[model samples]
Every structure is written in structure tokens, then in C-alpha cells.
Target chain A: MRPTPDPFTEALLARADDALVLGHRLSEWCGHAPTPEEDLALANLALDQIGLARALYAEVGAGSGRTEDELAYFRTDRDFRNCLLVEQPNGDFAHTIVRQFLYTAYADPFWRAAVGSADPALAAIAAKAELESAYHLRHASEWLIRLGDGTAESHARAQAALDALWPCTAELFEPEPKARLPDPVPLRAAWSATVDRVLARATLARPADGWAQTGGRRGRHTEAFGKMLAEMQSLARAHPGAVW
Target chain B: MSDDRRARAWAAAAAVVDPELPALTIADLGMLRDVTLAGDTIEVTITPSYTACPAMVVIGWEIEAALARAGLGPVRISTVLAPPWTSAWLSPEGRAKLAAAGIAPPPTAPADPGLFAVAAPACPRCASLATERISAFGATACKSLHRCLACREPFEAFKAHGDGSISNTASRDVLS
Candidate 1:
């Protein structure tokens, strides 16, 4: 029987799993992004996320003697602890931007605090990752304003994307009040203001918080995640060690 | 030992400043990478900062030409992927060279435990204040993002790659 994860291990593993899966999601755009700079940028961000994933996986798996590959590639979908927001479908450019905005906004503050954490390893990883994520936030923010405030088509499409993605942003801020990880209050509170700036710049309407959904933390996800996992893990499952 | 010959050869080779940052010589940025004397042929390994930087092919040709002018015929420039070139390879004198050219010198990043692995920075121009260090990675791979409080501009500092540890360098490549 498998043992339950320690709180610290769970937190680290959650971050690693989030990064690994999202990195794979971003990797899908390697050759498919609409522009060359965006293509390179996606790939670069994917690389950075994977790197961060490896560091966290290394730390979390330390108690269990698992390598980063073992945690990243060998795990089944049920074993993954990432928020559903990250695992959602990358429907369009706007979909991609909204996903990035939600995740990076929360991640920025998390990494900032993690850098000064009681755990030195997490702190070290957070230090470098913080710089990298800062750039990612800037990139995402620039696009937000551009799309939201651009031409009619851009403004309409960006507003529509924000409407679809607004629900997912809540998942990032969800945590049990007594949870041992960093405080959720500030992180939760920070998202609205952060998103507000981007939306305001983009001329998009703010996503109303009338009925925010929350199940990703409880191991429940939208339909999108299962499909994403199937595609991402197919090659790995088909050939266990098939590497070029 | 062809110390004198190597000096002149290196100096001649150094005349090729990095096309991106024109003020400093290729040697000053440590872009020359290595100067090996194999019988009569000199092999210099040059790695471009960005993967697709256009300057690489032209710089490779320039390296060969400079060597020919220095009387070292049959110079071959290989763009190496392994043992990748980092901006940290910029030398102290190189940063000073940049500042003396009127561009603000790169910041000397502190080797804080939370930031970089090392903490020694001498101005590429003035050779003063190892105390100032701005950021770890600079505008590109081969430079560090630094700001000399003394100079007061966000300058791109050349990373002086010394202590010749291939292992640490490899780790950095993997991190990137």
C-alpha cells in the first residue's frame, strides 16, 4: 500500500506536477504558435517550467527516492495533483493567455515567499525560478493589454476568452484554511487586483465572482484534463523507454 | 611553447569584436573560447550567444581571416554546442573596455547565497568595485544583467568565465 504524502512533500509535488504537465501543454505549441517570437517564447517558458518542475520533483521525491523522470513521466493521471486550470485545453491564443495569467499571477507570489522559506532547497529553486517567472508574467501581461485594448476583433476575442477562463482563476487561490503551505489569503486577494490591471488595460470586463468553482484541489477536474493527459502520456505509455 | 606567437595570434584574433557588442574584442568577452596550437593549424571554438544568432557564421569566418593575417594559416573555427558559452565569460578588463567606450559598465552582482554562485566582479573599464552586482543573467547568455550604483545605469555586464570548471558550466547549460 502507498503511504500518504507528507504536507511538505505534497506541496512540493503539487508544484512539480503543475509545472511538468503545464510544460507539456506549452510544448504542444512548439511549432504551432501563431508567431515566431511567440513560438520561441512558449518553448522557452516551457523549458523554464520543466526545469522548475525537476527541482521541486527532486525535493519532493527525496523522501520517496524517485527521480524527476519517474515522477513526471511514470505517474498515471490519477496520481497527478496539479490544479485543473493548468490542465485545461489550449483552445486558442486567448485561451493560452488566460491560462498563463491565472497561473503566473499566483505563482509569482508563491515563489517570492518560497524563496525565504524554512526549506533551503525550495528557497534556492525559488530564487532562480522567481526571476524566470517574472519574465513570464511580463510577457503574459503585455499580451493581455495588447489583445484587450487592440482592434475590434482582438478586443471581442480577448473578452470572450476572459469570460471562459474566469472560473479557472479561483482554483489557484484555493487552499484549506489550516493548510501548512504558505498563507492563501494574500495570494487569493492579490489575484483580483493583478487580473484587474491586465483586464483594465485590455479593455476587457472583469470576471464576476458570483459562483467560483473549486474541485481541482480535491482531485476533481474538468473534462479537459483527462484528454490532455491521454495525449501527453500516449507516447510514454506506448514505448516505456523509447527515447531518440 | 609559442607564448609570443600565441600572444600575437590571440591579439590578432582579439581584433574581431563581438558583432552584437562592438566595443569589446572577442577575446575580451572570452568569445575566442579557446586558442589551441595543434602543429601548424589553430582551432578556435566559438559559440554564438543566441542559438540562431546570425553573427555566428560571419564571426567564424572572421576568426579564420584574423588568424591568417597573424600568419597562422589554416585556422578553423568550430561552433561548439557542448561546453556552451555563457555571458559570464566576459572578463574584468572586458567590462572596463565597454565602459571606457562610454556605454555604462555592467552591474557587479553580489554573490549572495540566494542569488549567484560567485561574487567577484571587476569593471571591464575601471577595474573597481567588485561590491556591486545586479543580476545573474544579463541581456543574453554571454552577459550578466548588472547595474553599477557607482555608474547608475542598468548596464549589461560581461560575465567573466574563469575558474575553468566544466562541471559547473555544464550545470548552467542544463538549467538554461
Candidate 2:
């Protein structure tokens, strides 16, 4: 017996929407990765993340009276609520790893909160996602350490990556209005502080000189987002009314 | 009767070897997940070993042909990724059949259930062999490459999705 679509439910649903947008951003890097093995690895991981996103959004879409495809592809840029870091391009191999490390560190705790959400559907999806996110964090963290400490040249590039990516990482911890959701996740409280701890171990310093980037949450997207949407939805847009 | 005839027809027609990993049939590998009969329509669910696996479209065509030949009105094939297919779903008999065919089976899950093994992959070529997994991303997402020192032959190892761990080891191309 699902409750009559409460505010907490909406928040969980919003969170899922946010994740789906970010997952779409990452999927663009599928075949372009530097190495074939890495290309497959990243693409495969992107599929898993997208798979997780689809589950979340489809469940939320069911609750919201919209189809998942409609929710994902039809929405205007301003309607998306994803984190800013994920929408950033895979600048280089190190840059991509930096983005994943920072994002999953935050998501690991976020999913843990969702796993125990009062809403059972949210909880079940979170439980499954928690395992996936845990692996993602492991993958990112290992890469973070490897890139951070690898060689002088690799270290310099990774540091530059850290500097470029750090600003957006800040937005991941900022609180959203959980008060309105049917089963609000206590995501921010538990997720933010620990990522700060993990960053220290990466031997990477938080950007001390840069201003933090924000706005994807409020649907204020960077210029890159519209391009992302254009390509991602191109097939559907081009093949309108076409069916199997 | 008719049901037996339909199943037999399907079983024969769909026993096509999966193009990506030829050791197993589309049916035995669980890629051909389900088949349902309606007088005017036949519906099938096919699972892809990997999400991006190229073999799916071919399998879909095969399913249509098999069902159409059996005189089922129309064939409908759908793909499901959820409860995403893992090697765990590989039937025990599928393993024995794989091994009997000389292809190494997937790594065994420990009975302990508590201590999840992360690094070990056994070599199928030599009985006393120590195996080294070369890469987490195999020929496809569903398989990994491993070599046994005892036999000096590199083999494909099925990846268990249940284990949420991925080892960042080296990558070796699987020749077979």
C-alpha cells in the first residue's frame, strides 16, 4: 500500500531524477575512454549507474504520473535537479576519476540513508543501489589513490583535476528540502562530513582558491547540459512516433 | 500434445550457440529467459549477458523464427536487465555442461556466505594450477581473462556480479 504520493516520496523521486540526468552525462563517455579496456570498463560502469538511475526514476515516474522516457527526455533543462559535478565533461582520464571519486563518496552515504527510508520502495531500491554505489566508491577511491600517488607527471595532472573538480563537489553536500518528501532521506547530514575525511586520505587538498559551483539543483544548468540533452535525446527526437 | 510440439520445436530452433561465448546455447545460458504462448501471439523474455552485448538482436531474430515456424501467430521478444543477470543464475548443470565441453566454469562462490572471496579465480586448464585474473572487464562485461601457470593456457572466467568488488588488475586479451 503506497501512500498517496507524499512530499517525502516526491523528494526521493526528485533525487532519482537528479541521478538519471547525471548518469546520462557519464554515459556519453562510453566509447571515448582512453584505452579500450578502460573504455569498456567505464562504459560498463556507466551502464550500471544508468541502470540504477533507471530503476529509481522509473519507480518515481510511476508515482508521478509520467513515463520514465517522458521524465528523462521531455523535460526542459530547468526542470532537472542533478548535482553539478556529474554534468562536467570527462576532461581527461584523471578528471573523470576525480569526478567519480567525489560523487560516489557523497552517494555512498546518500544510498545508505535511502536504504532505511520509511518508504519501503525507496528502501529496497536504496538497498540494491547501496551495493552498487559501494563498488563504485571502491573503484573511484582506488583510482583516486593511484592517480594521486602514481608518478610526478600523473600526480601533477591529478592535482590539477582535483582543483578543477573540487568546486562542484561542494554542492553535493548542500541540503535539500527533505521536509516535503513522503519518506525524506537523511542524506546530507551523514554524507557530507565523511567525504571531507576521505578527501584528506586521497592526499588531495580541497581547492582553497576557487569559488564553489552550484545551480543544477535549482535547474540552473551550465551551457554543457543543453548539449548533453540534445545528444542523449536525439534518437527519440529524430525517430518520433517510431516503434518496434 | 501441441504444447509438447511447440516446446520441442522451440528447443530445437533456439539451441543456437551464443555468438559471444559459443560454449553455451542461448537457452542454457539463460539469455533466452522466457517463452509464453497465446493462441495468436507468442511472447519471450531474453536476458543479455552484458547490457551492451551485441548478440541480443540476433537472439531476438532467432526467437521470432523459432516461434513463427512452430505456427505461433506472432513473436514478441522483450529484454530485462533487472535483478541483473549474474553468474549465480547459471544453473549447476550449465556449469557441468560448460566444464564437460572443456570451457572453464565461473569461479565457485564460497559456501560460507559470510567471507566473500574477492581476488581468487581458479584455472581450468591444469588441475594443480594457480589462476591469475588479468582484467575485470572481460571479452564482455560477463567474462574475465585468467591464466593458469600449471597448464600455461589462458582461459575465460565468468564474472559473478553478486560480488560487488572489482579488481584493478592487468588486462589480457582472451584469444578464444
> Pick by DockQ: which candidate is best?
2
lDDT over C-alpha atoms for residue A159 of model 1: 80
Q: Report the poorest 10 consecutive residues by lDDT, candidate 1 chain B.
A: B167-176
Off by over 4 Å in 1: A176-180, A241-244, B1-176
| Candidate with best TM-score | 2
List, residue by residue over B1-176, the lDDT tens digit for candidate 2.
Answer: 65875576567445767767677777677666666676645667777654446677887786677666666546677776543454666767677767666556765561211111244456665654576655555566566566777777777767655432212101110100
lDDT of 2 by residue, A162-190 (tens): 88887886676566555422222344444
Off by over 4 Å in 2: A1-21, A28-31, A116-128, A174-201, A206-212, B1-22, B25-86, B97-104, B110-118, B147-153, B163-176
Our tally of clashes for model 2 stands at 7
True contacts kept of each: 0.00, 0.08
